[model samples]
Target: MATVAHEILSHIYSRIVSPQVKELRKYTAFSNNVYGELLPTFVSRIFKELELSSHQVFFDLGSGVGNCVLQAALETGCESYGCEIMENAAELADKQAVEFQERLKLWGIKAGSVTLITGDFLKIEEIGEILKKTNLVLVNNYAFDAELNGNLVNMFLDLREGTKIVSLKSFVPPGHNITAHNVESPINLLKVDEREFFTGSVSWTDAPGKYYISTIDRSRITKFLNSQE
Candidate 1:
């Protein structure tokens, strides 16, 4: 039954996602490359490697189709939330969440709930309210420039200690002392805990795409920033 349900879900996904991606591409203003969905395998890897459980609260900043949050909710039964700036992408994500919720019920699984917010992540007034309680946060910022990345790191300062931040790129090089020469936009808070090359799909292609995953240290956030000053 599990195998049959997996096959059914695959068929449903292939049918729905092609048109959804097409419709979203027509409306996305940002670089489409950065807006692709994280593969299911990658999401599983994240949960397993991090030892995440139902006790965690997950947030996906700049969540494109909200796949990360959806996977977190379904796999770990974690409280998951996604913030998307693109309206079409947000709508598609909401639709997918509803569909997946129904499908999971058919498989006798009760997925954790998900919330999709359609707005700029930076402008979300409830970010602090969310981040304060969050345990894990995902950011797909491969396309973000230095300034925007700096802004993101600054915003993360509000997260409670012990929260984890997973990002696609490193804000700074690892094993280097925090000297002025090593400083990149004064993001002294986020300490790099892990860096690895991960393989995943992009744009419905069979060809594999390579991306970096970096985990940040939240416990040392404030202390590290103050030491740097």
Candidate 2:
């Protein structure tokens, strides 16, 4: 039997979202670091891997048009939040969110709450508060610069233990080591797992790439401290 979520989301993509995306492509040209999208299949895989559920809260940093946010809410019944800094993209996301709500009524299906915020995620005080309670966070940091990635790491420091963060680029460097000198670094608190995504998983490129799942484990810091003692 086809799940209610699958049926509704299929209809929404074919009827509601596809046309808007087509129209958007006519005028909008995305540049590096400004926009990218993960396909629905890829997102579904992520939800499965993370075991997302109704009891959790999901956040998307640098969300482009709220695709992942909408999917997370409707499919998992998890409260979903997305923040987009680009004005045009944010406006489109707002419109899509409105339509998404109305369409859910037509299907007589209930979905989790969705909140779309338009602003610099790093500067948004409300987002900081929400992050403390968020169970999972997604950031499409494929094109993000080192400075921006560093800033994101600082923000992740406040995430609760066991919170998982998904990103296109690994926040913790490949060869990172927690020595006494850098014991205070936020990287020390994360345990990252790298995964491969084949071509067509993302909108930016046609080649295969890697993504990372970073779980906040304060125990790492504790272990380091205990070793010192």
- Taken over the whole model, the C-alpha lDDT of each candidate is 0.70, 0.85
**lDDT tens readout by residue for model 1, 1-229:** 2244335445546655667766766743555334666676666777777777888899999887777777788778789999988777787777777788777777777767788898988888898699888888888776777777878877876776567777766666556565556444335555565545444434445555444444445434455467878
Give the least accurate 10-residue stretch of model 2, judged by summed lDDT.
24-33
Q: Please, what is the TM-score per model? A: 0.80, 0.90
Reference-based lDDT, residue 20, model 2: 67
| Residue-by-residue lDDT tens digits, candidate 2, 27-105 | 3343434566887778888999999999999999988778888899998999999998877677778877887898888
Instruction: Kindly report which residue stretches of model 2 are placed more than 4 angstroms away from their true locations once superposed.
Output: 1-32
For model 1, the stretches where C-alpha displacement exceeds 4 angstroms are 1-12, 27-34, 173-176, 179-186, 201-229
Task: Give residue 50's error in model 2 in angstroms.
Answer: 0.4
